[model samples]
Target: MASKLGVSIVAVLATSVGVMLALALGLISLSIAAGIFLVLLVAMLVFHGAAMDFTSGLSDSEAFQKAVEEKEQREAEHEEWEKEYWGEHHPDYQGEEHH
Candidate 1:
């Protein structure tokens, strides 16, 4: 989804420029070029904003690694707790191993 948006943003920018130049050079009628240019310009703006938001949310390597490690640790702890609770409450749940 992100890649597609990025590609469309690039395409919009290129098309807008091309259309504007085409109109300026009198190679195409202004009315048709204007509509296409305006649409692409808006798309380019929206995608550019989205790209900025995506980039802003990115973290550095150490931070990302720490986040992943913490997530894994939390998951393991949760699984352990679930096993303890389920072992007492539903020991015969599919013949799970427990005291």
Candidate 2:
């Protein structure tokens, strides 16, 4: 896992790059680009929690383990949902052809 500080910095830099790319590509107006950057920065802050300093923490705690399990479950559920949705909506879906 990456340190929180490193992730935070990457998030900020990525957002900046995204905004600049969008503007340069004429995908968004300057105002909308700024809004996008602001939204992404706020999302990063929320997703990363309020910790400003990165410290080596124990990953063996029950809470940490449970959180990881929950995250994995959510990802699995999302993957299933995507498969189902695409299978229903896509014409070229292989599973549907087999059925």
lDDT score for candidate 1 against the true structure: 0.78
Number of clashes recorded per candidate: 0, 0
Off by over 4 Å in 2: 44-49, 52-99
TM-score of 1: 0.47
Model number with the top TM-score: 1
Q: Report the lDDT tens digits of candidate 1 across residue range 6-82.
A: 68867776887788789889999978997886777677788788777767775568678999999999988987887
Q: Give one digit per residue, the lDDT tens place, for model 2 in 1-99.
A: 367568878878887897899899998998998788788878777756645222234445766899899999998897777778878888566543334
Question: Model 1 residue 33 lDDT?
Answer: 92
The list of candidate 1 runs beyond 4 A from truth reads 1-18, 60-63, 90-99
